[model samples]
Target: MSAFEVTQPEIHTRPIAQTELWELVMEAADYRCHCTGGLCGSQHSKTGLRCPAVHDQTHRKGKGLVRLVAAPADLGLSDLAAVELPVDQLQAWCPSCYTAARNRAREADANARRIADGPEGTLF
Candidate 1:
């Protein structure tokens, strides 16, 4: 075994414009989670104003580190569409918040569709 190890970055560096957008979003959020909407299944008000999680730091769960992402505020948007959105429409989200929001949105959509279908195998 070698005496030292260098980590190799598997992800490619973002483009300049994308990088700038990400930086602005992160800066605007103060490098913390922007999940004050209460849609992520977390009562952010109880925890404090906005999520206290910061980027590049270990999560409270002692799991992986938190790396915030610049994504569209509308959780229903697809990943492709989210990336095309303008900086003003983007919000900085911690991984857990983003995952929870996306899951809730998807579940809501599925429920709506089920209701619209008017029950299983029923003809009105």
Candidate 2:
């Protein structure tokens, strides 16, 4: 039995309205993850050349099954916000890459805010 023959993957829970957008992004991505070393912290084996993982396929590194998502290329957006974007604004992402990228983006934003606010609790 194939993986698809089993129940739906956790990554595939996008609402029905989003399915068309998802397909558009996936197709543009050639059904492969677009992550380079920048986001996924990948080794570049699945790295610089573009991730080899395909939709509904086993991951190259055996981390888990590969389930790509159509999300905003800009990791700065919250998941809720990203989901609300149109298909043209989205990019194909594997879950691992997405999580790492989102975390990094949020941290960067926080750091920028921290810098702008100056040292915490400082009156000067």
**Against the hidden reference, what TM-scores do the models get?**
0.75, 0.74
Locate the minimum summed-lDDT window of 10 residues in model 2: 8-17
Give the C-alpha miss distance for residue 48 in model 1, angstroms: 1.6
Q: lDDT per prediction? A: 0.81, 0.76
Candidate 2 structure quality by residue, lDDT tens digits, 1-124: 8866877555543436667778778879888887776666665563455666678888877877787877788888877887678778888888887888778888999998888989778786
Error of 1 at 66 (Å): 1.4
Which residue pairs show backbone clashes in model 2? 44-47
- Candidate 2 ranges with C-alpha deviation above 4 Å: 1-17, 43-47, 119-124
Superposed Cα RMSD, model 1: 7.5
In candidate 1, stretches whose alpha carbon ends up further than 4 angstroms from where it belongs are 1-17, 119-124
Q: Which residue pairs clash in candidate 1?
A: none
